[model samples]
Target: MKILLLITPSEDIVEKFRLSLKDEYIVLTAYSFEQGSDLIRPDQINLIAIDITISESDKIKSWFARHRNIQDIMWLGIVSSDISEEELGKYSSIFHEIICTPISRNRLKIAIKNIQERLDILSENKHLKLLSIAYTEKERDTESVIRLSPGPLEKAVPLFRTFTASLDLDKLIDLFLDAVTDVVGVSRISFLLYNKEDDVYRVKASRGIHPDISSRIYLTPDSGMILWLSTRGRILRRDKVEGDVVSKGILIRAFREMEVLQSVVGIPIMYEGKLLCILNLDRKITSEPYSSMELEKLFILSNYFGKAIQDIYKYNIICNQKEYTQKILERMGTGVITVNEKEEIIIFNPKAEEILKEKAADIKGRPVEVLPEPITRLIRETIRDKKAYNKHEVISEEDNLYVEVDTYGLYDISGLLIGGVILLEDISAREELSREKKKGENLQLLNELVGRMAHELRNPLVAVRTFTQLMKDRYSDPEFQDFFFSTVTGEVEKLNSLIEKLIAFAHPIEYKFDIVDLGEVLDNSLESILRAVKTSNIQLIKNYTPGIFKIRADNKQIYKAFSYILQNSFNAMQSGGTLTMNVESVLKDATIKISVKDTGRGIPPEDFKKVFDPFYTTPEKGIGLGLPLSQKIIEEHGGKVSVSSVFNHGTTLTILLPIAAQTEEEV
Candidate 1:
């Protein structure tokens, strides 16, 4: 039971105090403030209660010389209902509690009990010498311990005060180790806490021991030292417990493990019935064995630490939960904002700050007006109408941003609207991807157009060179001379209009449909390739359906396509090669199949897939545009191209065109 003092002239108030505190405290009474000052012992009288009107704080301070211990005492003030506000406020700072009279017995008992707990903690701190604020500021190193205060209690005042200052587990261990070093003047120390998951005690923090050495040291449940600590439930010394040598069962190994950790003493801190931590210590700097008083102080400190560990873990759980939530928000890719019914921003994630170009710190907790007009409109609309909008695209012309927004109203368990949530995704990036795709398509088209122009110009140049080569042998033949001259002139005219062909390619080509003979078109294609060839041993074979091969089609385009195909077939050979043309109408399929086969160098296996890609080429091949241009022309006339090849053997290129309406003209 604690001693209590009541300083009030009111007999009725004093009677109420006695009834409330009679069972728990030694009730002492004084009639006035002057009389109470005489009873105040500063250290012994830790609790005091008085009528608010009678106590003069200045007079009491002057009489006591403002003792440090006196300030720590818990004071309770009792004031009447009619007391002025100024006086009530004045005493409020001086008292831990200000209960208005006439106070109920239960209320007085509760107030006094709370103050009693405070006073008990204050008394314990004083006993540990936690009186002055300067305790935490003092150096806790070895030298400070050497320049020591004589009494153990006097040296402990600052160290014990430092103990209660932190709730952080790691920092608290550091302080505890430092305090032990300061008070006990030990050369080395290590603090270990029990890990529930591992069922072992591991060093959480340490001093004096090598940094790498202590963390690796631990005590398992079955370890000799842990077993001893669990059974003994007290500090372990190197010499003996109950006057037996530590060289016996368990103690021998326990002492050995402690020696490895640079410790000769181990103090086990237990809470309730469980061991919470162990404080391992080496010898003192003075090389003297610990006194009984020093051991007693350590036990007191260890008891306090066991309780502190529980509180620290509780604090960490709450802090971790909040930190985990913050990390999730920081990592999200979408802008997220939550608001209250008053239209104030409560939560603004990092993505919101980036997308809106606004700082979260500046805009959070502010009204929705701080956001862009479109975003604010959505928030207001959702809150006012209590509806949800999904995938709402907002093209902000003035801000020049394309954004997709989603908004929903938030509600309570009772179905009343509490606030609203807004989600934003910037879809402008998708627009950029779409543009890049279009640009790639346009680039491919340009490649084909340029490739077509190169193919046209190269064909005429090859013809002029072939005719000139034939002149070397047939210059004296009249028939060959006339045909050569006419062909050469026609080839030169086509070369002169190369620039015009380019202009035609720059725009779109309009194919003119006409009634034409398909057999004549194949003959003209074979003749063009024969004129371009410099070889004489080349053989041509043709297979055509026995009928009038007439169709409504673009005659020039079909001729140009066949001419390039035959040219490719002949160009595959250097001197002697056989070129076969197979043209047939499949009446069942309603199509024309033209197969161009060459007994020349075939395309490699790897190059087969890229045969029709514009500008794809091989060594000594003509500009690589012939086949792609031919394929494009056939496809424009509703046809498809196919290829098959055998390396070094031969290559076959086939064209399939939708057979158009038949005409009366036959070839």
Candidate 2:
């Protein structure tokens, strides 16, 4: 039967052709040129017919020109219009017959019948040529070939039995040689294996062949027969291929390289569709050439040997991986323990054994009860819920150990929980460091507090002393006495207020959360600093968004924080400069951003980082608790204070706070 492929844009043509040829041919159809090009296999289809109008004639010609391999096949084109004699001659190479649209049924049938008959005659003649070559060579009787071996398969039993018991590739190759020796009088055997990294084929095993010949044979792209075997992956013989063009070209050159003029068989060993190696065997020069049956049996054995070598390579890889993994676990600092689904320990690394004060050999494969209570509980939780537990600290009083244990369930790719893994990290040193840091911070805070108190009190005390002296000297004067009393009372009140603020700054006070408007808070702070701004000839600019920007914060603390920031801006602008305070709400981030920009001399880059550190001051006077305290208050109210300065360009201090959803009355 013949295979016919029809290509056209019309579906009706494909269906009608398929029905007409249903009894005599296997019909395949494609709707586009691209689909037809992919379906054209020279070995499968006998004829190809393409239907195109005048517009797509050039497209089909280009497609045929590019695929020169399909040019050898029988191709016919159907056109929408009649072709002129000159144009037909021009396209004669692309299409054998150019038929017109609405084909004549009788003429098409007659043409197809002639084509089929011609193809059948050509196929038969090709088969006859191959048979003629086969008979010209020497042949052996069937009985004589069969008597040479008891059974080729039965001889391979020992090799198959040793496959599981050994991991030696060389021993398997030796066994394969012995199995094949009974079928053919083997003189020399050479195994050439391909190396992927080097891109070369080297002789791996050899016998009865010169060591120099095997060592010098490195198959590259230019290597004639070796490269052919790598690509074709077919069994080749010297006698049977002398008449064939392609095979003769490869085998004749390969035969010249052999030391002895005898029959040689080249078998390609394949695995996973890749040519892994080539097994070459040479029969004695005096003996008859190997029969077709023997050569076919050797090909099968070559495939079996390839699988054996592959298995050994994989086994060694797995063994190396295991060793590497074990070494890593031993050197790791963190303790590792793995338990199977039965709660029995499957692995206990060296660190785990050292931390727990137990031997790995003694506890491995033991129940979870072998571990301490805390670790046992963590493992149980992970196994029971099939989840991970992390960052839990455990302390062993008897061993004086403090460790952080993280547990996780080990699941396979299919999501089946197969085990649990626990990692233990020693954290005793970390805990000690934390305690010392806290102590240092507290001492520093105390020192800053004492300095602030002294600085605040000295001014008020000096004023009181001066007023008391005036009152003592001028007690008889009524006006002077009234002025002295009033001055003294004001100084005393200022002293009281200073003390109250110092106490609040130095201690932790319970904060009352309420809906406080940030804009109002800034206004109040600006009012307090307005006097300082006027005295310094500084201009103050307040740009507040027209909205009630409220936040859930301690009203008193936020006010204090705003006041401190305003004071800093006043102090920085010693000369006449502009201090712009801007307040805006960022609704997307749910925050209120307050920026206090000043045009005073910018802070030094080195001093910017320490501006908010307690007792860290650049000015000669005053303890530097103002900015630090402001930052602390804002942080306590769930806000942040950031300062950016560009040397001589002045500084900007911005405060961000979360916007409160409640109104002022909701407080």
Candidate 3:
């Protein structure tokens, strides 16, 4: 239930509203703006209806505009039909409804319902935004707790455990400071390593100290406390010394200036009976002195720390070697798996996980029996023979999957059998490529048949032309002459169709667009071309990236373009050659590059640029449309085709295409 306030000085409005006003609303009436201002209660009033004919209506509008609390209430204006456009526009923004001279109760109810619905929607939106912000803040808080809770020493211990031979000195010092600070309960610590040339122990690192203190403090042979410690290489505590010695020494004076009030302890780190560095700890702004137990622990820690420091080079060497080996295993393109004598998996690298489509954690320590029959048999054979074995295995678990697996018995340095190792190289695409090459051979045979077919049709074509000419010359009759001309035209058209059929074998028809993987298209094209060149003594190598290679393109047209380029390479390498195809995405350039390099009789430099021109051919028997058609297809996909060659060396052709824009998940 809500209240409505009505204001007007007109008798007619009062009379009309008195009769038509709804009973559900708690209505209040004011005859003047001053009366209405005093009567209005923002919390109680949900709607306001003001008659513009009243002399005080402008003053009422001004108050409503200025008071934000009142502005939220739905407003209605009672105006004459002749209200000017400018005034109407001004009031439209402020008022939810307008009533003409004759007020209708139904119209007022509808307006109120509409405004309430809009307000409800706005409230819901605000609520949702608040919830989103709250969730985001909760996530940030959780991350902050995890990141900042651990102490420096706690974090460094793991790094120490993983060490092989060497250690980072700076990191070691920081960790030592943290350990000492936690154990000794000191506010400040500094490590001053002996600098022989300077004849002083200079500050190498410090914790919880002002920049000025770190920069200025140093100990030389003449310094009081340092000189006293030099002779014995023992721990020194300020409280144990005579009061005068404690207060008057240069070290004490420096510590006082830095606001270290209670006490100080110095422990020297020695290696092979030679002084290395001094660890200085200070009790600052507190009256606590170093305890006997703290001093005992400090000596033991210093001894351990000294030995660790001496072996740092060894630790670093071990760490580096481990990292190097791990990086190699992770980055290898071949799948590597190792099994112990019990035939249980011991090592599974990333490539192994990818090829097998299983996680290392799930497979490691699992028996070889869990593997497929072919792979299991191969592993068993190698283990039994105590020798190396190699085999090509076709896995039809997925479409077009072929792999070459090499298995060998693993041995210890003593030449004793310990385990077995399996290496897998995917050759599915290569196998498919062999099939495509066979298809190319068939296409070549078809081409030869077409040529013979053209020769066979030529004799009949000639006879038809000669016979038609004779008929046209012998018969002047209009109907007979027309029939002869038509027959000759139809025969000529048939010959033209035959020539078109020949060209069709070389260039395919236009294609529709599709979302396709460019890498797959390249593999398919090479497979087709490989069959024709297999006996030509040519070798094909393909290097393609393993991730998203999708692009919006006409798959058939792109396949045709790739085929033409591959065929051209085959033609150039008639005797024998090697073709390398590499496909990789360049994110910074926002493009993908497909490079086809051939070791063949290379194109001359002068004709390199002209190779893509229409009908441009260097070889006497060349059709010249291959490169031009490839260029057209690439350009149509918002890409470019380029070539580089050195005479008698080789030629490399590159095609760059824009990567298709995709949504986050698709990318």
Question: Can you rank all candidates by lDDT, best first?
Answer: 1, 2, 3
Whole-model lDDT values for every prediction = 0.77, 0.73, 0.70
Candidate 3 yields a Cα-based lDDT of 0.70
Per-residue error for 523 in candidate 1, Å, reads 73
Q: Taking the tens digit of each residue's C-alpha lDDT, what string does model 2 give over 1-667?
A: 3578888877766776676677766778888878887887764477887786523557767877776565225766676557777766766666766666676666567667766676557644542332233322344554322133335445555666776667888777767666566535677777778887888878787777778777877666446656567666677666555445634665556665433422277788877657788787786444566765455546655776787888988998999999999999999999999999999999999999888889999999899998988888889888988768678888777767789989998889999999999999988788779779989988887887677668767877898888778766788999988887777887788678566556766799789999877777788777876753446578778787433677888878888888888888777777768999887767688787889998878888877778986656656325566787888889888889899998888889999999886343211
Ranking by TM-score: 2, 1, 3
The estimated TM-scores of all candidates read 0.39, 0.48, 0.31
Give the better candidate number (1 or 2) by TM-score.
2
Model 1 lDDT at residue 132: 30
RMSD, every candidate, angstroms: 20.3, 13.6, 35.4
> Pick by lDDT: which candidate is best?
1
Judged by TM-score, which candidate is best? Answer: 2
User: Per-residue lDDT for 1-667 in model 1, tens only?
Assistant: 3467888888888888788776666677999767786877642355788776565657644543453245656888788888888877877766788888889998887887788788668657655443231222235363342223545556556655655666777777777777678767899988888999998899888888887898799888888888888877768887435656654879888988888878888988876556788888898887766655466558667777776777777778889998998899889999999999999999999998888888999998899998888889999999999878899998786876678999999999999999999998988888678779889988986787577657767888898899899898999999999999889998887676445433433456579988777878988888877876789998878877434566667888788888878877888877688888887767788887889898998998888898876556666564465677777778888888999999899999988877665554322
The 10 consecutive residues of candidate 2 with the worst lDDT sum are 127-136
